[model samples]
Target: MSPVAAPAAGPSATPSADRVADVRALSDHLPRFFRLVQALKQAAGVDGRDRAALVLLFPLVRVGPLRQSALAELVHADPSTVSRHVAALVEQGLVQRVADETDGRATRLLVTDAGRAAAERLREERTAHLAAVTAGWSDDDLAVLTELFGRLLDDLTAALPADSRPAFPAPREKP
Candidate 1:
């Protein structure tokens, strides 16, 4: 795949006028957008540490049951971190460990009904929040933005070197 642009410190790193302006705008805006999303998830999530735990439910809820190892890879979290989150979720009855029918030694994490309710509540809350935030935006505008944002994310992910690490690896715990 082709790279989007050159890296800093490279002799070819100089940007043309338009690309520089667009890149600058993205650099300024995307972080704030991400921060708002994270904050919204935290606020809408159950409480305290469960806030983080609840966030983990999004992937499982979206894709159905998954092994802890697969879930960690999908979420780009460390195995130990995923284990802790899964433990808390199981304890809270939001998720359960079930024997993987194909492999007696392995278990899949399934979201309980309570977990679905919590996830739905968080989804609704986020939807309401965004609707309010985008009150001034027209349907056409929203559609355009959605399409553009999706394309941007796809391109960004594609731009990564195949050998590079996943985007969000949770730091490993200390010994």
Candidate 2:
């Protein structure tokens, strides 16, 4: 096996060297983060079917009912993929199609009572799990992490082409 060489920095990289290093660090940690999240989800007793339904359930629960296309935009997923997830959710009685109030001809996806219950349970369990993981961290450390992560997401969103950008809700002001 041969060691990989880092890419040579170019003119465009002048001002972003530190940011590039940060991105590399994030890339290295993401797999571990994802594995931990998956383990937590599994421990929460979220069955595969219901776990898959979370793709649709999350947005529906957060933003209220939305047209399929809008849900796709929010999740940064393909419309067809969202459709498939929505179909599974509907079959599991987690979500339902509702008439769009503003446009009668359009249908929106809404989470059912059962779906809300499942989502809340999963959310609570995840929160508890994360709290345990970060229990030793001080309040200031946690606050810094939250602020930096939000900033990273905002910067990434801004870098995307306008048409390719996802529809994230505006950030809420801290009380």
Candidate 3:
């Protein structure tokens, strides 16, 4: 089999052209990044049911009490899907439904102490996974990547119309 060729340097392209190419490259590479994160999640050793529960658990822990609909919006998942996972979480004692103080009839989802502990373990393990993945990179490089990723998310969210945008919270939060 023939070896694959390296991408062209595009040395003669204008700066704007170069940037546009970079953006295109980013679009192409974004899926790989997601897959890497998915791999990391799998490596965290959660079961299939656990995987779904943890998805909703971490966000609910980070954002505090939220209605089921809001949690669905926050995760960009279907409300019905969130409802099913939430039921499992409640059954597993990872989350609890509480009455909204503002409205007696309204229900909100809250992560339990067990949920917080589990999220913390997963968060730390994720960090260790990242550290291993980026072991060759400089600290400055890590910091810059974090800054750029945050800025990229902010810019992308801002580009959306106010009414149509999903709930985009800060990536990191004290739990």
Candidate 4:
């Protein structure tokens, strides 16, 4: 990439061509960010199969033992699709199904202890990877990046309006 021009240095400086160029340069960083996240996920030991398993397991871990219909809804996947993934996870001993006490005919899916361990390992790996990558970053630099990210997300969320947000709602209170 061509070098971006430096921003004007003045107490009352307004946006300049150089500042525009810099902002444009920053916009191009998103692909790099995506690649980094993908690499981090791989380093966390998530493969194609395990990635799918993680998608299915996340809801179980978050919402506890839930019915297949509820799990599917939480995951935003069709019941059959979630069922197949859950079946594979169950066979692998990463998830378990228990008879629902409230409804004997229904089964509730729960992540096994092994599954929690896997999730924890993945979390640790991701945290360590991010820490190592940002170890040399100054506090101000990190803070500015964090703030920029928050602003970007705010802009995106504003564009979507309330109805278009992800279907996942806040956890409901149990009786």
Candidate 5:
């Protein structure tokens, strides 16, 4: 089997022209990646929730309870849109509303046991799908892809303004 080709040099390693091309390539590819993942999720049955609702469940599962406003910011969605998603999730018994421990007047959304189960199933299905797709990939290639993607996510998160950043746990430091 042929080895996978390395990605083009990124901004730090490339000339300005190459960097611009690389950035443009990334911009062009991200939407395709998003659509592919969305399609995969849809095929995985997504627990009967719409994509937006399932997306909201992820942050809640990963980061624990959050205020609706905070969840909206984390998902980079409008508060009203998130509110609608939350309402649907709540109605499905996948999410619950709880009073904020720190604020008497405020409420937070928590995932239900059923929600956690669904999230776990979704994760497993996605992992299986990815594994099947990459079944021919070598371990080193998979490692490199995982490392680069994690770095990209960390860099993107860091580039956001401090106040605009999500309330999720901080990225881990490389040893």
Candidate 6:
């Protein structure tokens, strides 16, 4: 019998000058943008002790209770990695795991009263910060800024490579 042929390697992707220019523009704003997010997180009392905890808890506050696997998917982290965060939250009395009715072996995570309180604090801090930062702007301008920033994030995330550790799922079909 003839030997089977090996799969061909894909072409190497390289960015052109235009792409470089686009990247440079983004790079120029990245430091300030990240610093702002860091400052906000710090103001909300998210420290080293709760870095991963904040990541896990923030989404829960926004989206409500979720299966451990689903939470992992939302965070773009492995199940084991998410489990560790959940464990920590549970130990701190901030999150509780309840057995799924349909599947006893499966569990859904719910934020406890303490978790809700913490999440509220974070939300308030963010709202106050945004309000203060945009104090000089009109309501219409603030609305436009919010809409545009979300759109920009969507566009940039869609443009990212698959290997990138996305904060959420990509807008594409999974293989």
Which is the leading candidate under lDDT?
A: 5
| TM-score, candidate number 4 | 0.63
C-alpha root-mean-square deviation, candidate 5? 4.5
Task: Compute each candidate's TM-score over C-alphas.
Answer: 0.75, 0.71, 0.79, 0.63, 0.76, 0.65
Stretches of candidate 4 exceeding 4 Å from the true structure: 1-28, 39-46, 147-175
Clashes of each: 0, 0, 0, 0, 0, 0
Worst 10 residues of 1 by lDDT: 166-175
Q: lDDT of all predictions, in order shown?
A: 0.79, 0.78, 0.79, 0.73, 0.81, 0.74
lDDT at 45, model 1 = 52
Mind giving the per-residue lDDT tens digits that candidate 3 earns over 66-174? 9999888887788898888899888889898999999999999989999888788877877787789899999887777776777788878888888657564667432
Stretches of candidate 5 above 4 Å error? 1-24, 41-49, 169-175
Per-residue error (Å), model 5, residue 79: 1.2
Query: What value of lDDT does candidate 2 attain over all alpha carbons?
Result: 0.78
Report the C-alpha lDDT of model 1 over 56-162, residue by residue, as the tens digit.
89888877899999889877778998899899999999999999999999999999999999888877877788889899999888776776676776677678776
- Report residue 112 deviation for candidate 1 (angstroms): 1.6
User: lDDT tens string, model 4, 19-102?
Assistant: 667668778887898898787667667585667766676667776888888877766677888778888888888889899999
lDDT of 5 by residue, 1-175 (tens): 2233465586467555655676788899999999987776667665535766866788998888999998888878888888988998899899999999999999999999999887787668777878898899998887878777887888898998998777785444453
Best-fitting candidate, scored by TM-score: 3
Error of 5 at 102 (Å): 3.7
lDDT of 1 at 56: 83
Q: Which is better, 2 or 6, measured by lDDT?
A: 2
Better candidate number, 2 or 4, judged by TM-score: 2
- For residues 38-87, write the lDDT of model 2, one tens digit per residue: 88667768685567667567768878989999988887878888888889
